[model samples]
Target chain A: MAHEHDPPLDPVFKSSLRELKWIIVIWLVHFVWVLGYCSTYGYLTPETPLITVIGMPSWVFWGVFVPWIAATLVSSWFALTQIEDHALPDASPLPEKSEADEKGGADHE
Target chain B: MNEGSTAALLTFAGYTISVFALAILSNRVGKGKDFVGEYFLGSRSFGVWAFALTFAATNASGGSFTGFPALIYTHGWTLALWIAAYMVMPLVSMALIGKRMNQIARKTNALTIPEVLRARFESPAVGLVATSLLIFFMFFYLLAQFKAGGIILSTLFADEPLFQSAVSFVSQTTVNIPWVNQAEPDYLVCLIIFAAAVIIYVVYGGFRAVVWTDVMQGIVMFVGVILMLGMALWQVGGLDNATRKLEQMIPPEHGSAILSTGTVVATDQTFAKGTWLFDTGKVFRLGELAIIREGQSSTVPVKILKITTPFEVEGLNAKRISGQIPDPGLTVRVTDPKPYKYGAGQTGNYVRNPGPDSGNDVGFLAIGTAISFFIFWPFAATGQPSNMVRLLSFKDTRTLRYSIVTVAIYYSIIYFALIIIFCCARVLMPGMEIAPDQTMPAFAAQLTRDAGIPWLAGLLVAAPFAAVMSSVDSFLLVVSSAVVRDIYQQHVDRQAPEKMIKILSYSVTVIVGVLAVLCVLNPPQYLQDLIVFATGGLAACFLIPMVLSLYWPRMTANATIAAMLGGTGMHLGLTCWGYIADKEFRAYSFLGVNPFIWDLIGSLVIALIVIAVGPKPNRDLVLKFFHDTTSDGS
Candidate 1:
């Protein structure tokens, strides 16, 4: 707990873990929501005429295409904003300025 | 050789030689490095496009190019729904594992999935078990790819000079052995040639070569599918007209009345359950094979004006349409999936039974089956070790983020485009072949003939051929690496020299490639079945432990071992029992779903319960595992 020369560190790992859970939950919700629409909304009966999209059934369009757009947006948004790139906990403890880059990983600036 | 066939063969040769050149160049580039990292992981330096295309190409496999098209051709439009899960697949799989796996691999220099798991869990046993399971399922998966390669080559080149000569030479010189199918001269020759090409390129260039070739293959795959789609639709007139003609093939008043398809034509012929409703318009003369394509554009009947002949129902005449029959102005408007068969001499029509076995023999005619299919793929996708290899090989999180988006978009366009093209193929090539697996090549061949562009046939064959190679190369590496790196190096000889590892890597790649081909010489079933069985086993074994270990800190070594071994055992037991009990090919049905689901869910439950009841895991170990790579303390 007492490594010197680095700014006093507040561990964000626990909160990040919490944030990860929330992200997972949001992803799951989107999955369930899409499946729900597919099974519930698009599962049409014979008497009902299916609207065609791109020359396919309306239900299929909603089931696959709509969620495709939504998923693209949702995933990209999550990747951009929610995923904060952090250094892994330094397996080696060193002065803040001289944190060792194990194997000098090329990713480290 | 015909000029067109000669041209096509030359084009194929050029593509293969170019791929070999890339591999040779990459081998030079990859010289002087640790064999394990340089060979298997490419020293973990792939930029955005390399990573994205390789990842996509690896997953696209022969199934994507061949089997999927077959399903769409045979079963109809529901394939659009079946493969829809792919749109969210990259998000489900990549978003969860990509950044974390890359971070951890860089931190620990973990070169393989087992290496990653072993490091993450701090348990050699976990690594061993995972590696064993990977090798096992990868065999089945790899064999399927080989089978696909053989099938593609045989179908596309059946009329070629080399193939015909080889077949004649083999049959004339050889006697039929009890276990061997001496009849399949073309399949054996293609399998050997395909296997040789893949192993040589992969063994020489290692991961770098694989990735470079994957880039080429990925582009070929996209172009091939798009051009095939355009050609198929063009041959059938247009999308609007194609779907229109396809609708007419249906007997009006079943349940599939989607796409503004046709209402039934008032027929002068009403044959009962004995046979199909033939020539609903009563226009074709005797001895003419008339095809009844379902209509999507209007109420008028669209029938193919050709027929071969089937006198099977001559004695069972129920009732020919007398002068005045009601139009039944109401057309069935729902597009229900069903398997139908009609051709020369076959008087039967594809029927839709809303009761039981609705939508022909495609049992997934109901809502639940559709949803279940959607769920299986994404779930199985996450558990594949080859995919994990891709996840761990990315250069950075930024690369990962971009690849995820790119793959999602790529799959969406490619899979949907395939559905349209294959659906249209059903119209252009009516009753083309009985076996669904033959449809893609059949369609491609038909396209080449009709368009009079023989070189296009080379491109079409190359697409699936590329998919198979992309999948097989990665799998060969994964299987061989598990033996060399995880087993021999990690456990057998920690101090094994780099030279020995390099030699072992290359030789093991060849041996594994050779073994996969031999197993399929007596292949029990179709390539699709083999792929599914292997995928199920792999997912059942790895999905829970791998995904859970990533996020959950409390996961203990005991849980990992139990999940790894126990899950694999459970899948084996269930599949074995299912196989022994059922006469049908879909032998692994645990509670009406593919055994993968039950096995995965069952395995996860077992794992969680084991963790719940076991001793409190070492908090320090847990912290150490999670701490170093994922978060910064400051």
Candidate 2:
């Protein structure tokens, strides 16, 4: 790949944004799965229609976990996507400057 | 010889030795600095697995297991609403707060919460207030941990006279001093365990060591919860059986019909009509009612003869004297009633007391489940001072992230398992005649007795000790850091050497240990209550200032300082007086108008007002602090 050194494109922001997106995607998939399971199973049981797996009943799984997964995914995506990678410069390693090499007069105090 | 005590002793000894050995091994292989980071934050060098485990350890304390479950058992499932509220907190934190905090800490070389606040606000006042709140609140919180540890010890070992006698024998043999009487040798042993744990990680490795240990402890905790829960559930014949048992044990009136119908109530009391009134004798009064009972006077009618009336009354009759005296009988009634009918509502309907069958035990599990979301999310993105320090001690963030994630998954599983197990305990041991807080430990003992699984019971009993030790060590490190880094090093004498920092940290740790011992010696009546009050106060003082300073450019030092002081004052004053008055106020009603809610509201309000009214901060400095991307580049 050609090393395209885009002046303002901050790599850190890009990576963080990418990470956030993936997390949201995973969270969404989980949420949808839960919602489908709860809704489908919930429709089946006539008396206690809520399908309870383990100790957590189906309704609780729907109400609590589904919403939580959805919120995590959506909110994280929104927050992460807002930070524009083009607005900031890449945070690659910079050449080290010793104390003695400063342009201004050294004022240790 | 109580089997519970014997099992508990063996379990405790095993865990202590294992933890100690782990600490020693980590120390031996790692450099002092590396060990410090690992101990505090699990070497922040952790892979996803370690990171998850550390997070679990930090979050899961005695509060989660004992206090939370006890609260649920006492209050009913309505308390689960709080857990739902908390689910959003971590996601909010990660998406909104974590990234910025992590970036800032990495850039500024801030190793503690106080340091981060100090750096962001550019005001010593903010730092001082935040540190003070942290110390004060954490002290109470730590005390709760200690007390929980003591209870666990007593529960697990109280009946083992042989173990008690052995401990007593050791104490007497080691230091044969005359006229020395220790109350409950088991309590002292708990104290020593906590003290030793705190000293090792804090005195030697600092934040880094604490984190590493936290990571390990967190994993163990997660696994422990899952294993125990699974075993309990399987023993009770799975979810169907468990639910059936719970239904049978719980009165028909107390069943959750609404929840059963796959609907969540907007309010907690929707199912109130289906539950029995725990307090049955109370008369139901709608809106208001005044009771006026006409009866014969307790005092016989007295004849009064005055000097002026003596001439008239003496000859004919006596004048009856009746004076209004204070009514001796107490009439209990609700003054201000809502739409809900009193006593007719479900057992969990009452805000103050949820009846025994209120399905409140489920609340703890709900909270545990919520906590899992934050366990290893974002791969340790926030880098909390303690957590960050651990990360820095690690070789790289990739390792930290991996360890954290691994631990997170494990923790989630364990947490879910614990919930299942605890609920089963509730079903199996309905109205179990033990202290509500000791329900879990007691149940574990019962299981051991019934099933003859000494090892599992022993392990379950020792879990609380592990929790206490992990939490206490972390608290000590944070407290010591505040003293060493913020106070002694920063304020008292600038340019303090590393040696001096080490010395100060150790000294602070020792002092805190002594204080903890003294505080526990004569614990107050409402220790847990006091802890909640303190946590609310601290959260109020710091959360807003920290959040705003991280995200907002206009947050000036003046505004931050004002918010810190104003918020602290408002929260502390309201909380203190409110507790004294024993009446809830509108201003105080945030999250049931608890002190924490009040503090959070007060701080946020003050911060906003200050930000709006005060002059904008130095824009150049703000940008340099917040947007300096190159500052973190190695």
Candidate 1 residue-wise lDDT, B1-634, digit = tens: 7655665577678878988999999888888765678799887788889998999999888888777887676556656666766767877777666666666566566788887777665567677788888888788888888888888877767768976898777656545555446437677777877888899999989999999999999999999888888888778777766554444443212222221124433443221111223333321111122222343233323222222222211211122344222222222222342223221121112111111222344333455565666677777787888898998777766777788778877787788889888878866654433355777777777798789886678788788888988998999989988999888876777777788988888889999988888887666656566577788778778878877776676676668777877677777777678768874434466666767777877788888888888765654455554554233542
Find the candidate with the highest DockQ and give its number: 1
Every model: iRMSD: 9.4, 10.7
Query: Which lDDT tens digits does candidate 2 get at residues B1-634?
Result: 6555666677777776666666666666546552222333333344444444555566567777776565544433223333443333333333434444555555555556776666665456556666776777668766777777767766677677665776687566645443223335566665555566667655655554555667656755655666676667767778667654443332212111101212332433221111111112221111112222233112111111111112222222221122221222222222222211222222222111122322333222232333332232232223233333333333333433343334334434544455456666755544332246777677677676657676578777666556766777777777777776667755576555556665666778788867876677556777766765655555556666766776566676666666767666876687667666665321243233344445556777887887777666754445455443354431
In candidate 1, stretches whose alpha carbon ends up further than 4 angstroms from where it belongs are A1-34, A40-50, A87-109, B172-183, B251-362, B585-594, B628-634
lDDT of 1: 0.67
CAPRI category for model 1: incorrect
True-vs-predicted CA distance for residue B10, candidate 2, Å: 2.5
Question: Residue B238 lDDT in model 1?
Answer: 77
